[model samples]
Target: MSDTATVYRQRASARPRIEAEPPIRHVAVVGGGTAGWMTALLLAHSGYGPRLQVTVLESPQVGIIGVGEGSTSWLRGFFEELGIEESEWMPACHATYKSGIRFDGWSTRPGHESYFHAFASMLDNLTMTQFVDHVHRRLDGEDVHAHPDRYFLATRLAHACKAPRPRHEFPFDVWYGYHFDSVLLGAFLQRKAVERGIRHLPRHVVAVDRNERGDIASLQLEGGETLAADFFVDCTGFAGLLIDKTLQTPYVSYADALFNDAAVAMPTPLDGPIMSQTISTALRHGWAWTIPLTRRHGNGYVYSTAFCTPEQAETELRTQLGLLDADVPAKHLRMRTGRVEQHWHRNCLAVGLAQGFIEPLEATALMLVQRTASLFVDALEKGDLGAAAQATFNTAVNAQFDGTRDYIVAHYKTNTRTDTDYWRANAANTRLSEPLTRLLKTWLARRPIVGGIQQGTFGQGYPVMSWYSLLAGMGLFPDDGELRAPAAHEPPHSLAAIDNLIQRSALNFPDHRELLGAIPPRPREESLQVYFW
Candidate 1:
């Protein structure tokens, strides 16, 4: 043999064999809601061994805080991944397509000033920086009265109250989310998960037991049965049954940045045309989210208790919806704006409200749970994930939470509304993270661009275009005279092309109502009687 071959053979013979770590054969998820059920289903669908088992321990007495009624488009991919058909679930949950969110009366200008944060844009071919610069220049010149929504095809669809037909092959991508009944959604997911062989137990966890190594060993159910698993997932909402109360994870609060802590939600009978999007109308001391579903409307007033009372908020919501003097029952929700510093501990992981909560400003509750469970699934796929993987998961999840918190804070910090003490206090709040601070300073000097202040890879929560919309919507950008001049480089297409794109798509796409009518209607379950988050 050659010298190298002889050396390799000798070294291999001298080395000792190492054993692989044991795989996680069983996973026990505590709590049940959209988050717990989604995690269980995902794990069951991950193609683990037949011996691998997943069980969901849901309480029979706990109620669901049906506040996650709105969702981001990310859930669409999640559904597609799990082999779920839109046709079946949409009607089952009384769902509707959400093209985007429209913020009405958000600007300081007098009269009806509003803007849209659209999901789909026709400018997909252009870099985000290019789009931002073009819109900034246009706003400075002839389009001084322009809104960023003018550049998004989805905005046109939403405004026209139209939807793209599923059968038609479109050149551009169609982006959308859903507005659904959260409680109904949970029921649907629970049925699906149970059908797929995941054990669904309606039992409360009364006690938690841990191994000597500090990993979760088992859970004691209310009926005196002990359940053991190789790993545990905490989806116990604010209770944090496993990750927080048992593991003793540290937490970081966003209260200093995001002031809203209380919400009062009420549903109104469907009295008007169902819109194709979520409408967030700004209030004097808070904001009201109007989510239109096939059955009824989900409305809520999110405000800071520091500035407004719960009774005052409920009155404002009723008045805004023209239900003044109407004796309507309202549901109240209390929240703490914070997240655990570490989501994954020795052998336990927290998902959804158990991990953290930053309010529903961006409808991130469901999406965050999806992402957290997905990350844990990925770690499992890498054979054995020990301390290194735990550390990495915590770091990534923290960044996403903190990044989303900063984005929500920006809405308040950049607002020009000083009409109320709440607005004034929010605008003057001095607890901005350094990253957002740098970004806002840069935006003042010029327009925002992709990757400017966002954490994680592209396509994470709140992209650059979103920042531009919020800033321009609030009139926080520098004055036209001081704004940076457009880049000398020309755009690839003329403005007329964008207009043509919107016009052609609008003509081909069906009206939103027309599409909803086509979904072979199922008998609606008596509308869910519940309050909002």
Candidate 2:
């Protein structure tokens, strides 16, 4: 070989090589609310605090959508991962422990309508199918006056108006979430994120600038100031400031599958003692959720615009609530049920409402934000997210969204409430996704098998048991001996055993009000402004 070629090869071999791109250093999060602040804090906590500069651009003029006051039990793990102490923020946000949700008046059968989707996972070592079979036998007897929920500890506690005592650590048997003021929750998370050195920008973004490669370059502020970063997170809510308007990402709408499009949210004085769980009462056009916070009840009527006008919905809500007139103030919100075609595109990622939203039926908004943030952190830990990483992230995120949508759709589709066109249309055989349609068919022959719902591309959605709660609550159980043929040597749990478990839990758990009153009060300025959880 020539001397010049030999020298070049030696030098190339001598130099160190970089296996992957450098980790994201500067992240600019646009918008400020629960999603924005939550994203900022989570990113900051993911070993990016001092090195990775996280900036949140929040506008003082934009109002937050504070109706998502309820949450699922998944929030506990998120809070724990961030080392967020419950004592520090719970009271500040007017949060109360939520055991689960209770559904009332959704079924066609008289005198046996209400059922609970309790937080309790399972009883003894029995599988959900076995427990369900045990309950089915009792439900079939003409002389037996049994309710299946009585067997579960969480349900018993909720039915008795009791709440579990607060614990100081993680990994508990009885899972729980919370009902809190969403606006206040944003404020509380903002304080935590800012203290951790996340830059807070109280400026409105007037324009988005893109580089030659069509990636987000910077955000133009109202005063012509430019804020730039290496990565961008769009938490701008429904506006989709960076993801849609700038990148022109396609969106897949769920309008055909889901019907509710608007919500009339209001807060009212506590009519009675605070309960431990959210109450989802089935209404004519849709459902009404009553979330109990420490100070008041956050109530909303989530109804379809096709079935009723805003004025008509308000009137019906008032009638159901027994309100004489507009003594209580109410705000209306329009929602789009869909997701961006790609959650992570180019250099930008959309979180929360900016990504898309389903209704608050299962209180999944915050849960999705938490999941998406964590997933991004995991991806970043491996290497800088290139095309391949972005594809994986998008696939995971889309599966989660689709799974959650199917679960929510199940609530509407399984209902026997045919009192209105809204309910009738939902109950009618509409176009269900291939997976959900198959599962529904399998469930008709027998109880839902754990493997059927839990197996998928994303095995991280709802637990297999949750489907049982929802289906049972909607009165969709199979006939007496049709659930599953008993295993040859399988010993079954008796009703007496189940009743004993319920009695023990009821005796051990404290009343909901007792636990509420025990919490130390935090001092703050009182406000007359109505708030929703």
lDDT of each: 0.74, 0.75
Off by over 4 Å in 1: 1-22, 110-112, 121-123, 126-130, 136-146, 164-167, 451-460, 480-494, 520-533
Off by over 4 Å in 2: 1-22, 110-112, 121-130, 135-148, 166-172, 457-460, 478-492, 520-533
Show pairs that collide, candidate 1: none
Q: Can you write out model 2's per-residue Cα lDDT over 328-424, one digit (the tens) per residue?
A: 8888989999999899999998999999998888899998998898799878867768899999999999989988998888888888887789999
- Model 2 gets an lDDT of 0.75
Q: What RMSD does each model have against the real structure?
A: 9.7, 10.8
